[model samples]
Target: MPEGIEARLQEFDRKLRDGHFELLRQFLAKDYFGYSPGPGEPAASDRITDLVTDLKAALPDLTVAFDNIAVDAEGNATAEVTVQGTHKNELWGVPGSGDAVGWTGPVSIRAIGDRFAVRLDDLATPQRVGLVRQLRLVNPADEMDQPPHFPVVWPEFLLRLVFTGEVGDRPCSHLDQITVSDPPVSVCEQCVESDHIWPALRMCLVCGFVGCCDTSTNRHMAQHYQETGHCIFRSIRDDEGWIWCYEDDAFFDKAMLDRVG
Candidate 1:
């Protein structure tokens, strides 16, 4: 192991564990790059700082523990880290459920001068999925009931369909419930009133109510479904005409209308 590398690693762990995020700059290179799933590009130092800040805000009592740390003579290091926290605020698109959530993953660190560049394990997808599950955004029982090959592709529409039973035998149970197809407004009214911006829009098929998609911070569409039992909604953004069923957890292309009719 390189001289002082282990001590530096320990200091880095202490800084993060103690929520002294500002001190992290002392351990990270000026051109530090961090890698994780989702964004295809490496995250710059500023983005990494923002992410950690957001994480701390969401989990007020967040804890990070490093174990099995191994350092090589060339200043390359690997360690297994476990993160634990209680969901006290909204994270990603899911609202806080006050659930204690934890995930363990491997991380790599390479010393560049006195600073280090960190990269999370590429197979952290399961950890993310598990985190969402812990937030109660996904139901394991419902997932078990889902078809083996869910979101099956329909060649005619070139879109995926997630439905139960044989496609030829019966259509989506919510398909016939659609009472409205056209949206009356272009903007998410809730977002506008709340002074928030939305990335996309969805209109309820049952009541023609327009709201923001899940990607939006407000997630007005999901709130509308929970409050009104309105199960289906269609995208009103761009030319993408896909419909989603909140009850069935399925997706359907607008072309499905022509096929069934």
Candidate 2:
């Protein structure tokens, strides 16, 4: 929360607000990566002027709003932003919804000397499946007949680990130590890309079977649950993160409730 960084970010906001995109080049470094969420192609901007005209036309009301900004231990600046605008022109042939839609994703600013040299954006899902999951949380399955923007998998297998002899148990292990795996590649099957590895955390530090993360290409971990009807697996990474119930795409507190409910 240093005043200096905040001021810079605010200035970027104002420029975007006024559609003074031409000025963005001065602030961002060359070779900036800009991901057009949904069906459009991913683009890289070595200079902000690279896409200024196109962006302004597509997002007539385009405004950049900062949801959160963090400076990681690596000194990399990450900006989580929400882009909302009406589809004013032809974008990937979707025929302007003329409708305003919103999406969220992370962008990384690589700093060099006085300015950023590269801006990297790794995620932008126009499918917006997260919004559907939130909706289902409030309504029962029988009540809502609509499907999520993304696919949903119900678990095919069930496994449980307990601690302290209670439905609610004490922490047995941290996130980094947890691991999971099934037959063959196990959790690697569902991933979409090779850049990320599968089975983020193995089901068992004891077994060493690893699964892919949701962020990974195909969502192998979720598929592992659906195909095998398997219920639980230890996460691949360590942290305060919780075990997820694959069937519902939710975090589970008790093993029994972890089933596709």
- Which prediction has the highest TM-score against the true structure? 1
Question: How accurate locally, in lDDT, is each candidate?
Answer: 0.65, 0.43
Q: Report how far off residue 74 is in candidate 1 (Å).
A: 1.1
Model 1: residues >4 Å from true position, as ranges?
30-43, 122-125, 136-261
How would you encode candidate 1's per-residue C-alpha lDDT over 143-210 as one tens digit per residue? 43222222212221112201211111113578888889789999988788978876568899999999
Pick out the ten consecutive residues of candidate 1 with the lowest summed lDDT. Answer: 161-170
Each prediction's TM-score against the native? 0.49, 0.39
Q: Which consecutive 10 residues in model 2 have the weakest lDDT in total?
A: 158-167
Best by lDDT: 1
| Clash pairs, model 1 backbone | none
- Cα deviation of 249, candidate 1, in Å: 27
Query: Candidate 1 at 241: error in angstroms?
Result: 18
Candidate 2 residues lying further than 4 Å off, grouped into runs, are 1-6, 32-44, 47-52, 72-74, 117-261
Candidate 2 — what's its lDDT? 0.43
Cα displacement (angstroms), candidate 2, residue 169, comes to 46
